[model samples]
Target: MKRNTNYYIRKAHRYLGLFLGIQFLFWTLGGLYFSWSDIDKIHGEHLVMEKKDFSTTSGLIAPDSILIKINSRQPLTPIAKIELVETLGEPYYQLQLMTGEYRLFSAKTGHLKPQFTKDEVIEIARTYITFEAEVKETELLTIVSNHHEYRERHLPVWAIAFDYEGDPVVYVDAVTGQFERIRHNSWRVFDWLWMMHTMDYETRDNFGNWLLKAFSILGLITVLSGFLLFGVSYNKREFKFLKIKKS
Candidate 1:
């Protein structure tokens, strides 16, 4: 019975190790990277420009002017919030409707500026960065390209790539003219590692997938079998030592 149990334990341990060893190594390496990597750097905070507070001083355009312009164009929706924001030193009135629609108007002229053109997006990208460089390329993404990084963000974004050292890319909301996120080489590598660690290829965030569960069970079996074999070996050696001492 002992020999039969040992045989089964050895077989299970060896096969489980063969099947899940590389994944174990990946989990360790990815975990170490996540633990040591600076979360701010991973978010590419160092590549983008900081937001400057909008001035609330006099000479600013009145809120009524913006409301009049918007109400004249279309039927009124219940307003949730209205605020003044500046991009590239130009002031604009951002209106949020309770229906989840956003509108932007030029605070100076009260003209409706719904969407940003490619030139305007490039200018915004340049203003968002501290360094001086023309936009290298601009691609309009109708849908989120990578769901892992840009999950839950609004669609129809502008991917503006810069000709900087790390080849930084900024994703801006085309409709709202908001800076969605910044991505670079480090972020890409970190994202790939995260996907591997989570083992969720489709979403890259689900941790309770079947593959992970199966592997976890196999890993537990491997560890328990190893401990059982160690205990068995220790007992056999001690039995032999006792017999020798008695003789």
Candidate 2:
């Protein structure tokens, strides 16, 4: 009876553990990947600058004068979608071209800087003009825009580390051209809470402690079994069996 029970226990443990093992492996690997990607962004030693409103507090330039200055440039084409607005105590303008829009601002001194240099601005204009002129061309940026969506979804995180001065982030509504703040939640205990939940972290009192330990043990067993399954060969014909790949 003892031997029989041991046999069944081992069998049940083996199968149950294997089932949990695959899921645990995926979870742990996914969590590690999340951490690694975040680390790269936070560890980088670059200071990011945001376009600041020197006009509001410093009294550098009046709003009306800035608009008149930019209008004089005449390099901006179409002139169909020039919009001027003041929001959150800052003044900015958006110029819509055939392709995408250009955002320009008046320097604190009331001098207008072309959103791009003369040459750079012309090249950007050319891309839009070419796209508009193409007889059969789908919008060239549609595909690129889709890829950007994927990036934001799959790796939807931005982080900045300590010791860097100046505004680390600039938030703007692409549609509205309004300056805003990007508020990031504090990654403190709440972050740890999530990390623990995803990683199966637990203390002795928590039921999750036993559950996670059991799952981890199962995961380790599964990895070992996988190696064993690959290593064990009953016959030469088993070469084909070992190579059966998973997509």
Candidate 3:
């Protein structure tokens, strides 16, 4: 059995196909899911209530009072942003310090607030949901892995899980007393498919990885070898016979 370039190329194409077929299938599946799925729904837009307007905050204390109060406690701490935000239908001053620290102050009393209590966070989560659902689980997310859904978000958030249709979860900023994110089963499915599309199992967002690169190279070679095989097997005698008959 003498092995030639044709045989080797065909063999390489076959094995490469066997190896990369799964990844290709995953890429196609992920692509189809992503394209067909509504982006807003994937982000759990339909799960949460509509945003409430805080324009009628005439009774709230001025932000200057909150700034003065903050200066007394955290002296010399430079603030990056400040806004009068609402929590549980009450007004609160959200302060983001340049040091990446967040603090909340009572807009009615100008009192510095501690981190939102568990009960407060739960109520905040409840206020954001449009439907009536009982709480399933509540967790304080202080630590998480890189692949976690709430990763890279504000730390020490309150994760309030609900006994809803999608097992939906709402994260509240423990410090700023704001709703951080809403995650549901639909989002989880989207995330999983995104991981496959990117070929990243760990971070799930990295599109350039060694494993993906290797498979991509093998896939390219498989295509190139298939073309070469076709060229090698082409019989020019058939074309010559046709041309002679036409002449």
Question: How does each model score on lDDT?
Answer: 0.81, 0.41, 0.85
Tens-digit lDDT track of model 2 for 157-218 = 22211222322322233333343222122223233434444454432125456666776677
Candidate 3 has its poorest 10 consecutive residues by lDDT at 1-10
Candidate 1 weakest ten by summed lDDT: 143-152
Residue 6, candidate 1: Cα error in Å is 0.4
The list of candidate 3 runs beyond 4 A from truth reads 1-3, 236-247
Residue 44 displacement in candidate 2 (angstroms): 9.8
Q: Model 3's lDDT to the true fold?
A: 0.85
User: Across residues 1-247, which tens digit of lDDT does each residue of candidate 3 receive?
Assistant: 3338768878888888898888899989989888999999899888788889985687788898767766777684788998888877778888888988888888889887888888999988887888788899999889989778887888889999999998899999988889989999889988888888878889887778998888888888889988887787565557888899999
Provide TM-scores for the models: 0.86, 0.30, 0.89
Compute the lDDT for candidate 2: 0.41
Which runs in model 2 stand beyond 4 Å of their true positions?
Answer: 37-48, 56-175, 178-247
Going through the candidates in the order shown, the clash numbers are: 0, 0, 0
TM-score for model 1? 0.86
Off by over 4 Å in 1: 55-57, 145-149, 238-247
The most accurate candidate by TM-score is 3
